[model samples]
Target chain A: MIRRRFALSPALLMSLALAGLLIVVVLDLPPQPGLAGPVAQAMDQAGVGHPVTAVLLNFRGYDTFLELAVLMLAVLSIWSLGRRDPIPARPVQGPVMHGTLRHLIPVAVVTGGYLVWVGSSDSGGAFQGGAVLGAAGVMLMLSLPREMPMPPALLQRLGLSLGVFAFLAVGTAGLLAGHGFMGYPPAWAYHLILGIELAAAVSIALTLVLLFLGGRSRKVRHDR
Target chain B: MTVDVISPQIYLLCGVLLFVLGLHALVVRRHLLLKILAVNIMGSGVFMLLLGVAARGEGGIDPVPHALVITGIVVAVSATAVALVLMLKVKAATGLARLPLSGPED
Candidate 1:
C-alpha cells in the first residue's frame, strides 16, 4: 500500500500563523504601569476598600448599571422566544442527592449573601454572589421532583427590574442633589454602593435563573 | 539565557493562542453548539489578555481591567444564554441545528 500523505488543513495553518504573530507581539511589548497608582491614590475617596469593587460600583458605576440592563434584555429576548417545554419526568431522586441538596441549598444562600456583604473589602462581589445564587436555583430546578411553578408574573418582574430601578433611583437622586448623575457624596458612597450591590445581586440571580429556564412563565399565553 | 515563559506575559501568549484556536474552530465548525462554545472560548481569551496586561503594571494589578473583565463575564453569560435559546428556536423551525451552506452560484 502507498504511504498516506499527511494532510495540512488551511484552518490549522492560519490559526498557527496568527498565534505565532500574536505570541511575538505579546513577548515584545514593554512593561508599563497601568492605572493602579491613580486607583490607589483615590482609594480613600472611593468609599470601598477593594480597588476592583471601587472601580466597579463607584468609579464606573454606569457601566455596571448598563450591564444589569443587558442582563435584563437577554431574559426578555429569551422569554419572547416561547414558553419552555415542560420538563420531562425523571426517576425519583436517591437519598444522597436529596440529603445533599437539603444541606447545600441553605449553605449556598448563606454563602451568596456573605459574598455580597464581603465584596466591599474583599475579592467577592454582586456578580459572584449572584452566580452562586443562580447555581442554587438551577440545582433546585433540576433536582425537584414536582415541576416548580413559576412565581407570580408581577413579582418576578419586580425582582427582574429591581437592580436597574435601584440604580436609577440613586443616580437620579444624585443628579437632583448636584452630586452629578450616578455620583455618591463621599460620606454616603459606601452605604449607597452596598444598597445597589444587594439589589443587583438579587436581580442578577433572578435573571440567571430565568435565562436557565429559557422561556416565559407558563401562565402567560404563548404568542408566536 | 532561556526566555522567561513563566512571567505574566505567558498568559498573554496563551490568550492570543486561545483566540486564534477559537477563531479557527468558529470558522471550521458547523454545529451551532460548537459555534457557541468557540465564541465563549474567544471571550475567555480576551479576558485572559486583559488580566495579563493588567499584571504588567509596575506597582500592582490594574483594578480597571479587573472590573472590565468582571463586567465582560456577565455580559458574555447573558449573550451565551440568548444564543443558546436562539439555537434551540432555529432547530425547532428548521429541524437542523446548523446553517444552510451557501455555495457559489452555478
Candidate 2:
C-alpha cells in the first residue's frame, strides 16, 4: 500500500519566508527619531486639553465626521439587508449572574460617563466612553430574557443617526460662518467640541449595540 | 549590556508578522467567517504598525497618528460588523458557509 506524504503547502511556506525576511529588515533599521509637527501650535488653538482629542475633534474634525457617517452607513446597510429577531429566550440564570449584572451595569455606566468627561483633559475620549456604554448594553441584553422589550424603533433610529446629524449640522454652521466646513471659531471651539463628543458617544454606543444585534427588531420580547 | 526588548522595532516586527499571517489566512481560508476574521487581524496589524511609527517621533509620541489609529479602530470595527452581517445574509440565502471555488453559474 502506498502512503501519502504530508507537507506544508507551498503558499504557506512562501508566506512564512516572506514574514521572516520582513522581520530581519525591520530590525536592521535604525531607531527612528521623533519629528516635530504643527501639533504644538494646534494644541493651543484646539478647544480640549487632550492633544489627541483636539486633533480628532478639532484639527481633523472632517475625518471624524466622515468616520461617524461611515458607521451610520454600516448600520443602514445591515438593516436594509433584513431584520433579525432578537436572540431567543434562554433558561433563567443563577442568582450569581443576576447579582453581578446588577452591580456591574451601574459601574459601567458611571465609568463610561467619567471617560467622556475626562476625554477633554486626558487620554480618554468619546470612543472609549462609547465602547464602555456599548459593553453595558451588551451585558443588559445578555442578562435580560429575549422577551424583554427594547426601546421604541423611532428612538433607536434617532440614536443611530444622532452622531452624523450632529456632525453635519455643526460643519454646515461653520460653512455658513465662513470658517470653512467643520471649522470652529476659537472662542466657541471648546463648547462645540464637547457637544459633538456628547452626541457622538450616544450614537456610537447605540450603533454598536445594534450591530451586535445583527439587524433591526420591531420589538424585543421578554423571556420570563 | 542591556538591550531594549520593548523597542519600536519589536512592535513593528510583530505587526508585520501579524499582517502576513492575516494575509495568508485570507488567501487560504474558504470559510466566510474565517476570512472576515483574517481581514480584522490584518487591520489590527496596520494599526500596530502605525502606532509603532508614531512612537519614533522626537519630543514625544505624535498625537496625530495616535488620533488616526483611534479613528481607524472604530472604522475597522464598523466595517467588520457590516461584513459579518453580509456574510450571514449570504449564508441565509444559500445555506453555505464557504464560497464556491468557481464563479457563480450563469
Candidate 3:
C-alpha cells in the first residue's frame, strides 16, 4: 500500500520534471521563428508560387529529372549484369481480388488519367494517381498470379527512361527558347508539372516493380 | 479542450508497446523480410514521436517535417528493396537465411 501510494508520487515527480524542463527550454531558447537555413528558405520560396509539385518539377526540375536518370542508371546496371530472364506470360482467370479492385481498378485508372489531365491544379496528380494505378496492377499481379502478359523489354526501358527524357526535353526546350534549362519564364507552370508527373509516374512504377523481380538467381545441379 | 485535461496514457503505452514489439521482432525473427518489417515498425514508432514534437511545437504543425516524412517514405522503400535483394542473394548462395547460428559448440 505504501509502494502503491508512492507510485503516484513518482508519476507526479516525472510530470514536474517535464514541466520544469519545458519552462527552462522556453526561457533559454531564442525566439526566432521560421526556417533557420538557406535550403529550407529556398524550398519555401519555391513551394510558395506553386504547389509542392511545381517546386519538385520546375523550380528544381533539373535535379528532379536527374534523380530519375539515376534510378535509370541503377536499372541499367542490373541489365548489364547479364541477368535478364523474363517472366513468361500467364493466362488470366479469377474471382478478382477482394472484390474491391473490381471497383477500385477502374476508379484508380480514371483517377490517374484525371490526375495526369488536371495535374496543375489539385491534390490528385499523375505521380500520386499513377502510383495508385500501379498499386492496382500490383494488386492484380498478386491476386490473379496467372493472368496478364509480362511487360515487354522495350516498354520497360521506355518506362525507366520516360521521366529523364521528358525532363531533359522540357529543359532543352526551355534552353532553346533562351530561357535556360527548366525555365518557366512566362506562366508555363501547369505544362511543366504535367510533363514531370506523367513521366515520373511511369518511371517510378516500373523501377519499383522491376526492383522487386530482379533478385531471383537460377540454380543448376546434377546428381542421380 | 484544455491541454492538461488530456491524458497521454494510451499514446505513451502504445509507443512503448510498438517499440518493444519492433525490438522483439528484430531479435527473434529469422526471415530477413520480417526483420525489415520490424525495423519499419520501429521507424514508425520514432515517426510517432517526431509527430508528437511537431504537434507540441509553439508554431502550428511544421510543413517542413511533413515534407521530409514524405521523402523519407520513398527512401525507405528503396532501401528496403535493396536490402531484400541482398538478403535473397545471400540466401540463394548459402541456402540459409540470416547470420549463421551462434552456439556454445563451434
Top DockQ prediction, candidate number: 1
**Interface RMSD, every prediction, one decimal place:** 0.9, 2.0, 8.4
- Candidate that beats the other on DockQ, 1 or 2, i.e. the better one: 1
lDDT of 3 at A108: 70
Ranking by DockQ: 1, 2, 3
Query: Candidate 2, residues A65-115: lDDT per residue as tens digits?
Result: 999998898888888878876576565888888899989999999998889
Give one digit per residue, the lDDT tens place, for model 2 in B1-106. Answer: 1344467766798889899999999987789999999998988888888888787666678888888899899999999999998898888889998878877683
lDDT of 1 by residue, A1-224 (tens): 35335546887788888889988988888988899999999999888999999999988999999999999999999999998876666448899999999999999999999999899999999999999999999889888876777788899999999999999999899899998899889899999999999999999999999999899867644333
Cα deviation of A202, candidate 3, in Å: 2.0
Categorize the docking of model 1: high
The candidates' DockQ values read 0.87, 0.65, 0.16
lDDT of candidate 3 over B5-86, digit per residue (tens) = 2323233334445655676667656777788888887767656544444344344444444334444455556566666666
Give the C-alpha miss distance for residue A131 in model 3, angstroms. 1.8
Candidate structures ordered by TM-score, highest first: 1, 2, 3
Task: Write out fnat for all predictions, comma-separated.
Answer: 0.96, 0.71, 0.05
Candidate 3 residue lDDT tens string, A1-224: 13344444544555446545544543344433322233344544342233445445655566566666666665655444434333455435446445666888788778767766665554554456666666767766656544345566677778878888887887888899887888754556565667667777778777766665563222332121
Report the number of backbone clashes for model 1. 0
Pairs clashing within candidate 1: none
| RMSD to native, candidate 2 | 3.2
